[model samples]
Target: MEKSVAPDNNNLAHSYNHIGGVYMNIREYSKALSSHEKALKFYEKNLPPNHPDLTTCYNNIGSVFYSMGQYSKARSSYEKALEILETANPSNHNDLATCYNNIGAMYYHTGNYSEALLFYEKALKMIEKFLPPNHNNLAHSYNNIGGVYMNMREYSKALLFHEKALNIYENTLPANHPDLATCYNNIGSMCYSMGEYSKALSFCEKALEIREKTLPPNHPSSASPVVPQNTNKNNTYLLAASWTIAVTVAALVFMPKFRELNCTSAYEGGMKAVIWTDVLQALVMLVGLLSAIIQGLIVLGGFGPTFSIASKGGRIQFDNISIDPRVRHTVWSLLIGSTFNGLSIYGFNQTQIQRYMCVRTTRGAAQALFINAVGSAFIILSSCLIGIIIYAYYADCDPYTAKFISAIDQIFPYFVMEVFSNIPGLPGVFLACIFSGSLSTISSGLNSLAAVIIEDVYKGLMRGQLSDERQGFISKIFSIILGAVVMLLTYVVSHLEPILNAATSLFGALQGPIMGVFFLGFFFPRANHRGCLVGFVSGVALPLWMLVGSQITKNQRKSERLPLFTTNCALPINETITFSSPVRSDPLLDLYSVSYLWYSPIAVSTVLLVGLIVSYLTRPLKPHAVDPKLIIPIDDVFCCYLPKSVRHWLRCGVDHENYLNERVCTEFIE
Candidate 1:
């Protein structure tokens, strides 16, 4: 009946093509080839030799032959397709480019590099004539040609073409696009062939990063040899341990000389030396941070694009004002909780107090405090900006999710290696800057701790004064013992996940109670030593309980991660890809889930509340008997707007008149 409709009917050819397409989709290559050949026979008999239909029919046959690994047959069919397309539609540049690309792919697969190069160049020329320079079609042509050059062992030439493709893809496609992965893989292979192992490893890592984001978990590409593995983990750990030991030994050996140079009296001379060292370390840290920010912004084109992409990805978030104490970041936590945290550090911390005492006058101390505040703000802002830059760079491809790193804390170091590895000495400089910051902090802490032990504990208990030489000797001994203890504790801290949070929690839990005791002594005249002792103990116990409970139940209340996608991953042929179901979590509401930011506030409030109650119940100190010098005279400084009578009433009967007159007389003398 079909033959009766018309001899060699076009409709019959169309039906054969439909059948061939179905067979092709089902992987029945032989059946598909047969059906496609039948279609070609009918098309040839019904239409002119230069017809577009004949071109498509030949291309279909070429695809089936290619799928069957019949390189010769595929090349023959692709050549026919190219011939028909050129004769029938010479002005159709896209079609001509595609035909040339197909023929080139076939020749390349057949190991004919010269023929493949010829066809790929033709395709590239055709694409360039019509498409824009950064068009994906042009990139495809470039990639095909690059592959031919790579097979020909013309590595430099291969790299050039591959990089051209990469440039186009990087500019035009999404960061984690599968085509970008393929381009990265090609360039990585080229670099490996050229014996550029470092560059090869970097490119391979980039390729794997994209693949992990886009491809299925069990994809063959996930296990491909082209992606380099990190096989030097033990060596890295050994090197780190060796470096730490060397630095520690060196510091210990130089302790006496260092004390002679920096720590003459635990006040002005020692603090001046420490301050100078800190200034140098701060400069190095700033340089390292600025370098990372500048290079990252450049790679992302500019701050404009970097911020735009991050904003779109929901990384530029600052308006999370929810008052939920369990939320990780909120305006309330940042403002209220951070204020408490800062007060504890600057007001009560021994290290900061020693620095303040080093100043010549109260005005000088105030100036120093203002300067420190500004410097601390700058450091914090710079750190945050660096984090944003990192997010913008890996917005599409999360290195953590991609399994390139085991923890989120590693991202910064990983980013440094990825971006700064090519720049000689920059990575080392950054690492040195980090170590310098650590050393400065540790030295300051140890210095202040030794001073406190000698001046506050030993002298107070013995009710005696020591000579400068004896004091210095004791300080040096204390420093050695403290350093050893800190080194031991470092191993424990290193094992903690997200060390920043752990450190902060510990700081608040331990230091908050001590800060509260200082507050009680300075501001609350009625708070006796016994009340303070009870308050401090209660404050420490409560936060410690919370901290320990939080750590124990942290896994149960895991926060939702930012969205990640693998939609751009290429699927393996004839393989079933199954996505795992999302795991559902129903966390219990508990005090332990409170954010770490709230720890300081909780401890401070607990101490204030408990100490006031205890003081009242246990026959509080008579305000009249309290020494005026022991109190801060807050009413005089902060309540001076009120009349003297009102200020006196606020002073809780503690007579500060003598103290105020003495201060006025001293200022007049100065």
Candidate 2:
């Protein structure tokens, strides 16, 4: 038989390299390394020393090593790639940028910040020289440099470069693009670090909004957007929203100048003053609510009579805890699910964390948390009572039927207007309180967003330090942009379902997975970042899928509409308003019908379960490698009491006790 001609070495090398790329994406690091090494061997034998194929093979190998946490090996591979690139291409070429960036990353991971900065700056300059001003490559370069500066604690330089990246992304990418969201998120983090909480919040929200639009809800990004699609044909709404956004943006952009020319006293208020101002704002709200309640009581006689009238409407019952998860609320959902929901909201929310961090001591944070819980309870109870009172007054005479309010949500506002109508300036005072409350909430959120952008995204990327004045200047400008972004979201919210309902559902849907990740980090030492990330994505997707399905089921529903009361009772008997009931029952899909209350628990449970499984399946972090501080100290106590069988089943390693002991020792030493 004739000897079979061996496949061309170059072709074989290309094939192996292509295979390695696929393996790398799927995170099969060992397989990826094997394929890339084979490619490199073949390339070396068949191609010239400085061939581009050799450069690619070396770069791929470096990336695989980096992913494997083999920093030294990654650096060596990257250096080889850089050598090949320098020989094969000119000094100013974009290919050199990639090698430089890779090497910079290697140095960054290895704690050689100075070398990282040098290499990153070199890469940035090289790319800037060849790439267009707004090129995405330039954005990448700017972002990398910004990140380095942020790590070095040079806030102003970081902000400058990050803003450059963000500006470029804004100019070149779509509004909802994921890359733009990344930039926004980074800037938000940076602002957060600098203590500009409101601005940080606004920028973070912008990032979230963008991510929701671009990435699929199940993506291992942030809590996913529940809305299925980004584009809508509501041109009129879009146009109106665009106009509002423009005005808001203009106002925010010019706010600092306006402050300079006008309210020079604003920045003079220190943290203590800010806290006092918040207290005053809270008092204004309490006064408004108390005044409204008093007026309501006077108008509706005593509590007993008002309660009797409302009891007839039958809207204040809460005994609906059926096994079906699709029910809106149940005793089971409220007690159990709400705990998870609350934990998710308070435990891991960056906004809450930012506030807690402002406290001078851990004890202060604890006290603040306790106060917040108590205050929240009081507010909720008071609000609920007010609602009951309103229902009692309106039960016999529906406001919608009487044309007293256009929407159900407006009933309270209308009642406020009616009650304070006789009292001169009282209504205005109440309205002002409401306005101030809104302003405070929005301002806080915006500041927080700006902080996150600056701290997380921009701070580690720049080359120099920033003065306090310059930092404040950047913060103010950033806050304006974020505020405008929020205004745009308001428009989107208006076009959606009732804001409160949508917001509640969205929160429940998103919070579960986030909380799960937090618990994984704090409670499960075996859980690696990859597993948590994967589980988070899976967890988010499950609830999102259910929510989307539920919405669809609701839209397709054909059944008797819930009864609406009419004014016919007050009118002549002959003029009674009668509604025809539909014959079909609106049967909901099982998963879709699951109560919204259960979403948090389901999400939390799913993430935890999935994360545990995935962590075990993957190369979990060795007990010795995990930082003890990251794990909850109390968790070890719980683990210690577990049955031997349970421990064995969990592969709670034989050295687990020693691991915890070692960690404690490390903590003591540190």
Candidate 3:
């Protein structure tokens, strides 16, 4: 009794739909768009224009446009989607909610707050009647409504929705569940906006604590840590704070002209010495990191974002432990961001993978991952202690107030600049270390981006065997081109701390929407492709709206609006800060009090909620209709976590012990 199925128009269209969804999630927008177009053509030819599937096709197109930030085009496509869905679906059916949410989001993006609220309300009412009260989808509507209020600076209204969302989520989901924590953090942020520092700090700390408990010790958990408080009045904290100020002024005047004066004679000699030294130290950094950090800086000129500190004769510090989330920084953020950053640069990165794979066995590779996770933990803690000690140095020997470099990220670099500049070959070594960092990072990105393009984008358009040799050649070309791009980027990225903040935050802007889509794919079995597609579009649109709003806010007097993206200290860090006396952090950095770490959880949850509501009101693709391979994992995507022993067995039938040798491997010194 085998049921017969044919690869007809429905099947072909279905295949293209799933493929498009896959590409869309990965940020391969162009390919995703093309795939959706192919599906649309097949649907139009095979089915009537008003077919339910055609509505989905329109919605899919809208989604791709939304991701690409083509708002007008997205709206047009979504309107067509609504027209088809209305024609095919009865009023009050749950499916229309998808269209409602998306269209609402388009309005939201256009800054039509009232219209956005109306549409969101409409979607919320429909879901209220049809879904369970505690359903995640229901909570999403609350969050969405809250978001509109938040944008309008209606703190009271926003807080109302945030609390409602949390009530449902905290009771139903696990404590470590990221969504619940986000609601807490979001609410905390709302309080901060209202000048309720104690309340705001309370919520932010709660969210952060949850994250710290749940995430891998090496992963970025809840990102918003309570900012430390500033204590002054003839104390050590005041002196360190003074040193930071001094460095800030001095660097502003002298360094800019020094580069102008020194020119090429200084450049070539330094680059040669630095690059070679950096490679060796960069390798050494994998093990004896603290010593390497100190020595590497010795080779470089100064301690700053662009150089080392000893070279500059200055330092940065922190006073007491600040539990205030509204403060600019916390132990959690530095540690969490560092952890996540390390994971990202190492995990799924081809350059790191290449190095590990070169080892004889899977066990060797796994050992590397293991060593990395464990070693990195210690390294992170060490960095924290180092920051503490150096700041102590500033307090002890109050350096001149004119020593602060370009931006805060420069603190470390300035330290390097100080340590390395005076020595003969030291600056060369430090420069080498910097180049190696750039190389490793850029090389990994080159391989990853090329693989994504070739595998997802080019596979359908061109034909050839994708042999390892072919991949190698393509990767090399990618590496070269990407290398040039990095150089250009590096040249333009001079204000290191601000650029670092912006670059990481730029990634922040993407994580929310992408993670939301992935969650739907993995867990929401009932969510068909149409719902998936529409939801994703809405999810991204919300953040893009946030970004646009931030840009517009930058136009207003800083005093008028609720501080959104503007970099206010998450807490006041100066010797004195109050409602009247605000601590001015690095004016150059574009971040507000909220760190980029919060973005991952917040962004992911937003996409999921928006996407789910939209999908619930739209058509769900038939699971069996899509290729099993497309839906299932053929290999662990987290292949990076392979244990050293098992990995060795797979790679080469090599003999290896499960236990790592306890003996220290070497006494080598850089």
Candidate 4:
């Protein structure tokens, strides 16, 4: 029956070899050895002693023995395989290189470094001759030799080989590939051995960063179980602090040069260059976001299925009209609270105000604002769609619940890596998009901050004057100083979970009062300086106190989150997962549980109410005494359809006719 089915002995032997491989993969070493020995018996009976089939059989047997930790038997089998390969074809071949690497691994495992080095070099030479320069096989050979050198205490040689492997890996592998992390770790060990502590730390950090990106948070490899005995714990802290300071100082010294080379053209070329750069960055951000959304939709088989899955999972919701402040994303909070926040940002923020000043006319600035509003809306909608897509993809297998990531914020990046890892350059484009947005924001913020400090404080308040060159120098210095301050603040904010809320809450706390002051000066002619001062102080204090108190009490409140499931998680049979119930707090702690969205509205309303009360009580400015140019003509701008009586009431005592006459006289004078 066997002969009728297959006359060829080689074919029957190949079946046994495949069975052996399967058993080997499942770690059933005894069964794998039995299968490989049966294959060997067949190959010996029909094939020549030095046939490639016999050589492969020997290699399979050797692999099983290696798995069984019988090094002597493994080495003998490997030697037989190599001898057969050498006798069959003496010329260099990939099979010969692989055999050499396997034998080298055996020797290395047995602590025979010299023999390992000899065989590893032989494999490396053969690989270099036959394979392309950046082939992964060549990297494997280099890494094998590097390991031998490291065990031999030859730090320099180990470093050179490890770096060669790392170069190939960086060029050929994905950014967060495990092989790259291994190479980094090897190089770091070599550096540590050579007493190059800083370089060691840098490479170690690189390895850790890659591991953090790729591995589960609870992975054994992610833990630091042991530290080097010679290493000082305090030195690590000191080195980290020193490194941060060094980077900041280097940035201070070199950032001006970098900005001059890359960004000065935009600033010096005026609004056109700046606008074009912003447009390009916006395009990049949109393209990246769209790519992610498109990829996610495709994975989910289209928008229909994606939304269906998300809706089923209870991720799609829009009718949350509850007025409860403790509710995180109610319609009332989003609309009313976000309106005040938007006003603080777009209406009165210094960075935005600087952009407004760049326009030659109010009409041009208004056009810019409209365009910005449309673009912002599009981006926001795209982000929400992305959130839904991510939810749908991970509906069954939630990464956070599976411990794939340590924080909720890491989910997006984790999603990108999981989905786009197979497509080269897409991850890089996403990263570039993130950095582009960050750089634009930071640069604009620093520039505006420098301008405010120099113009409002140095010149206006201190009465300081300097030449253009001196002023330019001082502005750069101030930008560097502000940049450093921002970096420190970033470090502090990094510890806060759900950083988006923390950041927006902080922004509202600080900027709400500033926006209120702007509102008082622009529309309320009766608002006195004393009223503005007191109102600004009150607005800042209230929101800031709330934000800080909420942060302090955050642990006591239940985190508002979408449902997560680990029912489909690929956990071991013996492993058990237990989820703790949400923390319960006293009713008195509810004050700190207010939605972060409400902070801006609360601050703005407080300012408006306080400012108006103080103005009336502490001698308000008379309508005639107030300058027409100082107050915006609210009635003239928006109340043209209303009756004269209604328009007068809407003006808050600012005389529109006087403002119109004054504007006409000014235009005539000009």
- Tens-place lDDT per residue, model 2, 406-503, is 46667777667656655867876688678767765665666666667777666767647867777666667777788788788887666544455566
In model 4, the Cα lDDT at residue 107 comes to 62
Order of candidates by TM-score, top first? 1, 4, 2, 3
Q: Over the stretch 509-593, how does candidate 3's per-residue lDDT look in tens digits?
A: 5655565666677555445666666666766665555544443333321332111110111211111100111234444224343
Across 428-538, the per-residue lDDT of candidate 4 in tens digits comes to: 778878877876787778778887898878887656567888777777788778888989998888877587898789888888888888888887889998999999999
Q: Give the CA lDDT, 0 to 100, for residue 70 in model 3.
A: 55
Candidate 3 stretches with Cα past 4 Å from truth are 1-281, 284-327, 330-367, 396-404, 419-424, 464-471, 495-499, 530-593, 622-670
Candidate 4 RMSD to the correct structure: 19.6
Each candidate: what lDDT?
A: 0.77, 0.68, 0.56, 0.76
Between candidates 1 and 4, the one scoring higher on TM-score is 1
Tell me the spans in candidate 4 whose CA falls farther than 4 Å from its real position: 1-277, 460-464, 572-588, 633-643, 646-653, 661-670
Each prediction's total of clashing residue pairs, residues at least 3 apart in sequence or on different chains, is 0, 60, 91, 0
Ranked by TM-score, the better of candidates 2 and 4 is 4
Strongest candidate by TM-score: 1
| Better structure of 1 and 3 per lDDT | 1
Question: Candidate 1 lDDT, tens digit per residue, 185-217?
Answer: 888888878877678778888888887887655
In model 1, residue pairs whose N, Cα or C atoms come closer than 3 Å (at least 3 residues apart or on different chains), thus clashing, are: none
Question: Global CA lDDT of candidate 3, please?
Answer: 0.56
lDDT of model 3 at position 179: 72
Pairs of residues clashing in candidate 4: none
**Better candidate number, 1 or 2, judged by TM-score:** 1
